[model samples]
Target: MKKKHHRVALFAATGVAALLAPAALRAQESGAIQLEQIDVSGGPAQARTAGATAEKGAVGPIDARQLLPADLQTFAGSASRVSSQDLANQRPLTTHDALRNVPGAATVSDDGYGRHSGISLRGSPFRRSRKVLVMEDGVPINFSTYLDAGTHYTPPMDRLESIDVLKGPLVNYGPLNNHGVVNFRNLSPFGPKETVFSAGVGSTEGADQRVNNTRHAHTRQTFDNVGVVLSYSGLNAGGSWDAERLGYDDFYGALGIRGDNQDLTVSGGYFRQRDRYDEDNFSGTLADFKKYRHDKKRAAEAGHFPVSCGRCYEWNTYNADYFRAQVAHNLHIDSKTTLSTRIYGNHHDRARFYVSDDSDNPPSDFVMEGRDRLYRNYGADSRIEFADLPLFGGVTHTVQAGLRYEEHFFDNKNRLGSTNERLDFGNRGSLDGKQKLTAQSFAGFAQTAIQITPTFSVVPGVRLERYKISFRDFDEPGNDGHSTYVQALPMLSFAWEVAPTTTLYGGYHRGLSPHIVRDVLDTDTGYIAPKKEIGDNLQIGVRTKAVRGLTFDGAYFHSDIRNYQFGEAFQSNLGDRVFSSLDKARFDGVELSARLDSRAFTNSPWNVYGEGVYTFVNSKIVRGTADGGVNVAGNEVPESMKHTANLTLGVEHDSGLDASLSWTYRGSFYTDALNLPMNPLDVEEGKVKGVWLLSARASYKVTKELTAWVSGQNLTNEFYVSDRSDGAKPGVGRTVMGGLTLKFH
Candidate 1:
């Protein structure tokens, strides 16, 4: 083994010398000239001759091009961008993998697949990602952005070109931006014409086996001034847990028309998913979990508990369909002025049929519960931007203002039936409960960038929002109610260039999250209402490229939340949770991100690169009472981990050989505001232990048009508890996969 290691090192050194010798000699013969920086935003700025709007209105306000590693100092706030090249190099199996290394972002709910998991930002709670604003192509994607705000669907990874994470004082994309925003950018239809296909398959090695398959195709073309794009992605897999099956397919299309001074784009897509997974059997008591971690079906047998027999447990299933459409138009009215508008609509239908045995006693008959839900949403936004306008005393200003209107409706129904019945359409049980919610909102915002001097700028903005929501409970007519609210939120941010490659930036904003329909008027108590969340957020950060081949970004943030909300689960049953609020809560933290590349220092064929992110948060409930009227003051906030970190190190050669090894760590946190210790029953109110995972991937370009790759996750085969929403649940075990890609023009 020692001799083999030495030989490998010698071979790498020889290859590096052979590839760098000519470049080194050329630099000596003539003065070295660096290449011009490439714009990485992949937005209109790259494809259009007219100067694109800095904040491109409804399409997206933040420009990702300023987030390049070498140009981080140009951005005015804490932000990061994962480019198309980064995604191709990572080849992530789930969205968690793709976002693991981003500062201030955390994935708490894995769900084995990335489809419906939670993505938390900063100090927000990670359950269902309720506190973060998620967008795709600059449009909201939550189940009901104004009524429910629970994310249930996400676009497939194969169809995306990049992801942008913007943190701190989000004044342009509100209503739910208490923490920050995450935007998923689709591949532009205006890019070069090409066709690409990808296929892969793999399996896990363990007591419970899981098989995986993936296929995707994308095509783009243009004729004269018209451009078109079509894409599809499909997945079939045996999920992480036993007796679990998952499958989904996504289809998208886009058409673009470009004229001398204006452009129009129309895009739409459909996504369908079906999965057979026993929701009740996914978790169990602590003793049962430790003894039979992988044997979810047989866990109850250990305690001599009568368990649901063979087919009874397999009745649980989930089905969902999403239909979306949007139109965006940009008009260059003049050299320094532009107007943009976006209109979008979507319809989502989802149903879950799960076997339930929630009786307190040991023996009970299994019953099927069907939860059906539907949502419809429509919105239109328009904005105008004026750039480089002279105001007074040699001061220039860039101003942007917009107006938005939105309407949303949600319908939910619950039904119960015997397990022996044939659940054909999953909506066939007797109606037991029903609810309907509707909301309409109107908002306006204006922000101006005042260039006080050449090296410093100050941005001031304010948003006025008004919304009305109504809720109706069919089973209980007394629970019907309606409410209206209006808010004026203001923000201020500044950026100062202290050096050629260093920037100091900070901001302050007022954040708000309106009460959901159910929370606005609690059905459990006809007239009891929970207050909405209001927070005062402050942040300061620095970005520097002082080192030759390294870029570093660090920030400190603090948030004071009034009427902070949290949820608690029942100890004895599943699907029984309650939401409550505290008078005041506080969260303060620091986030650090750094990246290093050897290629930045020298023109070497074999380059080494490393990147990492670390976060530290201190959260506390200043004033609150538990369900039993216990004072919970000074206790740590639930689901707020104190520490989390991720690191990746890799090597790339000009020959198209790339490999990377990553390590991710998630710190321990409590499940309730009381910060209760572990109990034998293994209920949700307890401390969850921390865990670390290791993953490795390598890919080689066999030819110009073809590439091959393989990856392994959880390489240590670590068996650990992932989450405790209902009870202790096991994380994904070790898995390996390999794949190939083909591209042509």
Candidate 2:
């Protein structure tokens, strides 16, 4: 009977959303970096082909890391970006690897392959990146972000042109942009039939680490008014743990039609991956981990996990597929007013097969636990911008407004498996329990930049959002209800261009987040009654080119977070993993950074360059955990890094030779809210210590179209822990790779 209800609900929601949704409306400049000669008034250019670069003026684009501070826009707060050049310079292989230059971003990689990444901002919990809005271009990358928000998939960096990281929601972006927004901008399509191809292989000195290969290709074509672009990236490699492996492939395709007064872009993506998840650990005591901290001779001598001896070599297998589509249109309404509309849909399926170490049970019996999760969502995001308006002063107001309407669905089945036929609902493999959750949202926002003076501007914005969700538990017919959330957020900020090359910025905003649906144990309270989180974000910063060769951006922020949420892991009645919630917390931090190019100070083709970022976070438990005995009001929040710093120094010669060295440091952090040590030295697998990693790279251009490079990570062979959960997760050790690329123009 419940199955019948689930099908009906899912079909109805999907049908309506599909019919009305078009794709993401990528206005020319909502929050993207502006390329030289491109009209900043226009949103992302539709005329540009996919994978095209700014060098061609057709919108391929560059990253933030490639821009000088003088080129950055004067927003209320700092927005950081990483360019394709920076990515290539570092020879990145994972999402985290590509983002290594961004400040204040903490990528807590459980295992170094980046199958599962923890990106936290302002000291938010590192799991699932619940506080950050991760997007591709202008569309949400995760299906039903409010439902199962995890790092299920991250588009390969090789096919991307730039990545933009903004704090809070942009006026044109849909809803739920409280903490931060990270958007992966793909390479735009270039016209005249252009193709770009590249490939490389890497090896790491760690247990089970193997030589991995990464390949990517992009092509663009234009015929009269229509343009098309297709790009793909694939990876075949070993997981960062013992006896593990991984495979991933993804593609992005788009079609654009440019007209005299209007333009349209339709884009789609599909991603697939298979990974081995090994959780073999000793988890015994501090002394035990100490014995293996420097042991790289082989896979550890032994493990203390609760699994059979022979079966201990096993682990879970994860498989996932994600699909997304978007249609964006821009209308230049007589130059002064422009309209942009985007309709998008995303659907995904993920499953994990559990393998146990039970000697008494047969291999077939060991695979009795499994998880299947599904998500579907479609919506329209619309925005209209008035380039210049008559407000307090003539031609001084740049105003914009947007609206979003979306429908979403989530379904999951985790049970004792009776057969290998999983994921599909057919027979459902001895379903122990099932849940079908659905939601719909309507959001609206408006903002205007009031130029109070030639060198100063005040921007004020507001976003209103409302959502209704239905939660149904198939096992218990009565355990279901409707959860509703509504929020009106207001923001005001100012940017003062005090000098020719300096801008002072500051802002205060009210933040809002929907009441999330949690997968909790039956014993957990407020499972269905989770409340929406609310907080205040305040920041002040500066962007300046004070010296001929030096540029810097710095900021300090404070947040009074209220009714926030934290997950507490627990075992359910069926021995399944579940999470309950912790009610309130507070996070505040400081971020500082600087960049330099010697050409400005000394007119020479032989140049020196340097950049660095440092962050300090002070997070605390305000309302404490749900458990009655624990009073953690004054303690530091779990996994809140005390300090993090990164620096890079390099030299570039006119001869086409470049070399750079980078250092990354992370301060110690507690594993849990208890603020207690798990090791005899006051730290253990559950309490992570500080870490420092060194990296270096050099590349030489044989010709303008061909380049050769060599790179190394953890060059010092540093030994450190990344994650200290049930067991320790080691950081990526020394790795070296050499590759050559040839580009035909």
Best by TM-score: 1
List TM-score per model, in order: 0.89, 0.86
For residues 435-473, write the lDDT of model 1, one tens digit per residue.
Answer: 998888888888877778767878888988888878888
* CA lDDT of each prediction against the hidden true structure: 0.71, 0.64
Worst 10 residues of 1 by lDDT: 22-31
Model 2 residue runs over 4 Å out of place are 1-71, 168-176, 190-193, 278-282, 290-303, 309-315, 357-365, 393-395, 419-430, 520-527, 569-583, 626-628, 680-685
| Per-prediction backbone clash count | 0, 25
Name the regions of candidate 1 deviating beyond 4 angstroms: 1-72, 205-210, 281-287, 300-307, 358-366, 424-427, 519-525, 573-575, 680-684
